[model samples]
Target: MKPADSAAVALLGLTVLGLAAPTAAAQVEPDPMVAGQRVRISDGRRCAQDGAARVSSRLFGPVVLRPGEGGMAAQARVAEGAAPGRYPVTIHCASGGASFTETVTVRDARVEGLNAAQAAGGLALLALAAGAAFWLRRTVGGRS
Candidate 1:
């Protein structure tokens, strides 16, 4: 093959590969978010420069996105009644008419509360405080 023709074929191959490459994906911070908590959505592709991008999820209704560092960002509150499970969140960019979906896991708010270990720690602290108080009373009262 002619050197020039080979160069053209190489360029075409690179072009095809570039076009087929996947774009950066959108992301939700604080994965395994608790119901009713606010979550930040970040668009890694910066596709919302036109200021018409939107994000939506079953757990949280449509949220209008605004330009943010690194890309676009938006905050949405998970419904208080959202069930504990994984839900798909989609970001639609009006500029390129491109949409990306990311899965977000919603956890029950109860999970945010103290667990068994924490409860045990609290109980231990309480008992120690009570014991200290009793000892102080016994020593001071006897001296009196």
Candidate 2:
């Protein structure tokens, strides 16, 4: 197909995919990243009702839960001063309990940096698929 036809078909496919995609409320991806900006961490499990009296020293602040009912979540921040590498996060409870640790990566991002990565990955995939399609088309033509 011509370049214009190919581009139009691709655009139309994207339009359909966008319309068919699930709503934001259904997102189940781990909260490693949020708001296309801040990264978040949770124990992936709740703390005890009384809470962790002693939090690990490595943690930024006291691991406190939302004061109310439901699953208790200990909170910490991936601060702006924090490095862009992965940090080991551990939640310690004082009541002779086992602690849970999670490694959360905080990335330093500028709009241009993310844009470049997305564009590069998309182009690489497009190139690979176009090459495969050309090979398949050639094989079919040759066999016929």
Candidate 3:
């Protein structure tokens, strides 16, 4: 291929990769429970948040993470027919940055969803408050 053609192809390839990289990396379904909650975590290149203004790709692995790429956990991953152990996840993001991880003791254990525990606790509190309101209304009406 001609030099110009090769350059054009390379540019096209980079453009495609740029478009797809964010979709592939740091794409965790927004869990309201986890969002804005400061859980102990690490950052990586995949740390590019959804709808972020700037994103930086990174490597996730066992090593001290620093500012920039090749740093923290990008997203969750489980490969087919791969050996099991804690692997590093790296990420880099302009909007926000994070670096940390949880142990994958069992494969396919991490499912995305709201926390049942938090939801249940919130519901219980609401119930108790409702019961109290009913009791107060009854007492006030009887006194009047």
Task: Tell me each candidate's TM-score.
Answer: 0.57, 0.41, 0.30
Please identify model 1 stretches exceeding 4 Å from their true place: 1-24, 46-48, 109-144
What lDDT would candidate 3 get against the real structure? 0.39
RMSD of each: 22.6, 10.1, 22.3
Q: Which ten residues in a row have the lowest lDDT in candidate 1?
A: 2-11
Which candidate tops lDDT?
A: 1
* Candidate 1 colliding pairs: none
* Candidate 1: tens digits of C-alpha lDDT, residues 45-128: 657476768887788887988886668888888898888899998888876678888887787654455656678977876775
Worst 10 residues of 3 by lDDT: 31-40
- Cα lDDT over the full model 2: 0.48
As a TM-score, model 2 comes out at 0.41
| lDDT of each residue in 25-101, candidate 2, tens digit only | 11112334322343333433445556543344242555453323433344454444655666566655446656665
Q: How far is candidate 2 from the true structure (C-alpha RMSD, Å)?
A: 10.1
